[model samples]
Target: MNLYWHRRDLRGTDNRGLARAVSVSEGPVAPVFVFDPTVLEHAAPVRVACLLEALEGLRAWYRERGSDLLVVRGEASDAIPRLAAEYEADAVVWADDYSGLARERDRAVTAALEDDGVACESVHDSIHHEPGSITPNEGAHYSVFSYFWKKWRDREKREPLEPPAADALADVAGDPLPSRSELGFDKPTATPQSVTQAAARERTTEFCSGPIYRYADNRDKPAVDGTSRLSVHLKWGTIGIRKVYAATQRAAERATTDDDRESVAAFQRQLAWREFYAHVLAFNPETVTENFSGYEHPIPWRNDPDELAAWKAGETGYPIVDAGMRQLQAEGWIHNRVRMLVASFLTKDLLIDWREGYDWFRRNLADHETANDVGGWQWAGSTGTDAQPYFRVFNPMKQGREYDPDADYIREYIPELEGVPADAIHDWHDLDPDRRAQLAPSYPAPIVDHGERREGAIAAFEQARGE
Candidate 1:
């Protein structure tokens, strides 16, 4: 018997590891998912809830095929071997994961299995291109995105594999599925709807049929539902990157004009950004906590608890920043443009460390991947590879007017501003004193003067650079 361990790759279809295992196993094959305590202890409630939903879906799918999924909770290194011994399984197969902790856990598990003479195999299933596969012609990794993406475009991606046959594993015993509350975590009564392979395919089809052609022009506007909204699905492996890549290529091929094709191409390039950050994380794990370039820039952060609380509570008095923060708190997601704006306000304008904002997002975002979260925060703080220059600060009011000209998004999140006119919405100070009091009685004034904060940030950056 062989065991196929599910981790990030939650779906059974187009799963490279499960496919390979089913092809090679002669005896009964069992699918398993281990809710490792090491991971669970740190996971946010929403993430834990989402994982449970995915696991339930997988279990139902497997039950229909006469096999069952074995769900367990323990250290994966010990759990895999113990489960193997119990089932007398000959080998274990799984998708290769790229996070530092995941890599270390896999190493320990593989070593223990090897010592016990149980064969363990890992297959690449998560990323479109394996890390370090598309390096520069000089055999070194490219630091910039354009060169790497150009090379990424030329490389051939392997066609997605089919789902494993159910008959391949007929005699395996399945364990009872556990609920979120059973694991000592409160199940969310109202959670974001889970994304399955079918759902993802529908979304991809819908996008390609219409919105994809307008993606380049519409993506930055938060008021419009322009983005793929598939980040969480991608993070959990409900949809394979290869599948997305192939669908996007097809869209580009069928596009009626060069501009439409270019839109699809641009959207595809964002996927490259996702992979590029993952590769960077694999090469420089320290970037998870520190700057990649080893620059020790001292930032003078404020210790104002009330100000921090205001920022967290979405009462920062900056319309754009407050809208983004509130959106994240309520929806477990924020638009990409708003993400940049809020991050810039927290780190650059408010003079708080980016790590604070990063941690806040990690606790709240349903789509939070460590690589993307860290990359985004550092990019906004001007401490990451190919980051925006430190001096290039975003003006919140101006950004609000540009991205959400009519203040629709702001009004949706910041109800206190509902009565404010569109022209004066971005600049709350423009309201007459009596009207401002009547419209937003409880709204706090802007926490920091933008001009002074901008100068402070610039001077701090100059000092750090030895100017």
Candidate 2:
């Protein structure tokens, strides 16, 4: 018998690692999941809630297969090996996780299992390609995405494997799944759009059907349902990365227009970006806390408590930034463009440390991936590899007017801006005092002048870089 451990990969469908465990097992395979308290402490309330919901669905899936997802609560290093010994399993199989914490835990678990004479098998199922698989001639990973993208596109992707069917099963009764209260987290008021594999599959089909055709033109616009809201699903492994890639390929093959094909390719590039960040994280694990670029030393940061509080409360007085923050609070998600804008505003415009924004997002974003969040925050803050130039500051007002041209996105999240005219929404501060008062009386004034802050940020960057 073999033990199949579930981590982020929650689903039974197209799970290569799970398939591998069943294929190689001499008898029935015991599927197990452990909820580690240490890990839960780092997860946000919304993330924990979403994870539990997904696990509930996964448990049902396992039951339908005449087996159970043996649930446990403890450190995985201890829980997994103990379970292996209890079941007398010959091998423990699981998908490899690339996060810093996961890597450390895996090492400890592997060492413990080795001492017990149980073999451990791992499969790279979450990402299309294994992290660190693609690399430059001289380096272990690519810092620039363009270089990574070219190699990524040229490499053949693995076809998703079918889920394993176990004829026999472990006879042990599973522990009852824990609740949010039991996990020391409240059930968040806001959660993910869906938590089941069925929902993720339906979304993938629907997106590939038509939305992908127009993705290029509409993806950056925040007001419409233009982009695939699949990050959370991907993060939780409700759907496999290869399945999404295959769906995109099918969409491309069926495309009648060049634009459609281009859009499909564009969306696939985003998948590459996801892997790109993962690769960076795998090679430079220290980037999680240290700046990837190594140029953040002696940098000046305002770190104003009032400004940070305002930013967190979505009262920055910049409509776009406020709207994004409010959206994050309300839905536990935000648009990609708005994410960059908000990060830029915090790190550059507000002169705050990027780590502050990174930590906040880590605790707030329902779709949080350590690598992607770190990559994005560092990119926006100009402290990451191949990051944006530090001297370049994002003008939140211009971004608001540009991406959310009709101001619908702003109005959707910030009620105070609802009555403001579309023409005046992005420049509400520039309006006549009487009209500004009449339109958005409750809205606060700009927290910091963008023009002055932009110069200050540039000067600080110059000093940090010793210009």
Candidate 3:
């Protein structure tokens, strides 16, 4: 008997590891999902809720196929081997997961299973190319994105494996799925609570069919929903990257104009960025907790409780920054452009450590990934590999005017700014104190002076580099 362990890859369709496990199984194949406490211990409420919904969907899927999903709650090393013993399983198969504590846990479980004489197998199902597969001609990993992307495009992608036939697992002992509360996690009350594989598919189809062509033109505007909105799905492996890549390729081929092709290409490049960061993480796992370039510098970060509270509550008095923070709190997600802006405001403007923002995002964002979140925060702080230049600072007011010229995004999240004129919306400080108070009575004053903070950030980076 063979066991297929579900981790991030929750869906049944087009699942690389699951399909492979079914294909090689000689007897009844059991599908298992472990509510590993080690992983869930740190998961935020929203992420916990989304994971429960996905597992519920997977349970129904296995049931309809006349098989069962065995859910174990404990340390994976104990749970997986215990389950394997129950089934007298010859081998255990699973999708390979990358870093964070999950990777370490997997390693420990694999070692334990191998020691117990159970064959353990892993398949790459997360990203298109394995981390070490693509490298420079000199046999070193490519640190630059464009060069990696060029090679990424040239490589032939593997055809997505078909979903296993129903006959693959006609009979197996099934287990019940657990609720978030059952696992000692609170249920999230957010817009993404209803997310499922079917919903994810619909979202993918809708974006690819219509909005994708104009993605490059409008992706920066948070007021407009121009993005794929599939990051959560991708992060959790609810959908396959190959499937999305194939769909994009097909759309590109059907394009009647060069502009359309370029749009598709641009979207595809973002996908490459996803993999690029993953590769970086694979090469240097320490990047999760330290500077990617090994730059060691002492930063005199403010641990001001009031400033941190203001930033988190979206009372920073900067409309763009506040909108991004509020949106993240309300929906457990934020736009890509705003993600950069807010991260910059936190790390650069407030002079807080990037780790603070990183940890917060890891707790809140439903689509959070270790590699992507770390890459983003460090890039904003200019301390990461292939990061933005240290001296370059993003002016929040300018970024708002450039991306959200009409103040539509600001109004959506910062309702107090609704009556403020578009011209003055980006610079509330210019208004007289009494008039500004009348317009946004509930909004707090800007927590930090941007001009001074910019200079401080530059000096801090220079000092760090010298160290």
Candidate number with greatest lDDT: 2
The candidate that wins on TM-score is 2
Ranking by lDDT: 2, 3, 1
The lDDT for every candidate, in the order shown, is 0.83, 0.89, 0.84
TM-score of each: 0.95, 0.98, 0.97
User: Which of candidates 2 and 3 reaches a greater lDDT?
Assistant: 2
Candidate 2 lDDT (Cα, 0 to 1): 0.89
Estimate the Cα RMSD of every predicted model relative to the unseen true structure.
1.8, 1.2, 1.6
- Count of steric clashes across candidates, in order: 0, 0, 1
> Over the stretch 1-467, how does candidate 3's per-residue lDDT look in tens digits?
88899999988887999988887788767889888877887788999888888888877888888887888888999999998998898889998877857678989899989988998889998899988899988744678888999989888887766777777864776556776778787766556735577877788888888788998897898889999998899988878888888888888888888888898888999998888898888877888888776556576676576777778888888889999999989899999999999988888888888888898888889998898999898888787868888788899999999999989998898888877887788877456778778777877667688999899888887887784
Give the distance in Å from residue 298's predicted Cα in candidate 2 to where it truly belongs: 2.0
Tens-digit lDDT string for candidate 2 (1-467): 89999999999988988888888888788999999877887898989888988999998888887788999999988999999999999999999889898999889889999999999999999898897789899889999999999999999998877777546555556778988898888767565677789889999999999999999999999998999999999999999988888999999999998988999999999999999999999888888998888753578888998898899999988899999999998888999999999999999988899999999898888999999999999999999978989888988888888899999999999998876788888887576767777888998888788999999999988888888
Better of 1 and 2 by TM-score: 2
- Residue 234: error of model 1 in Å? 0.4
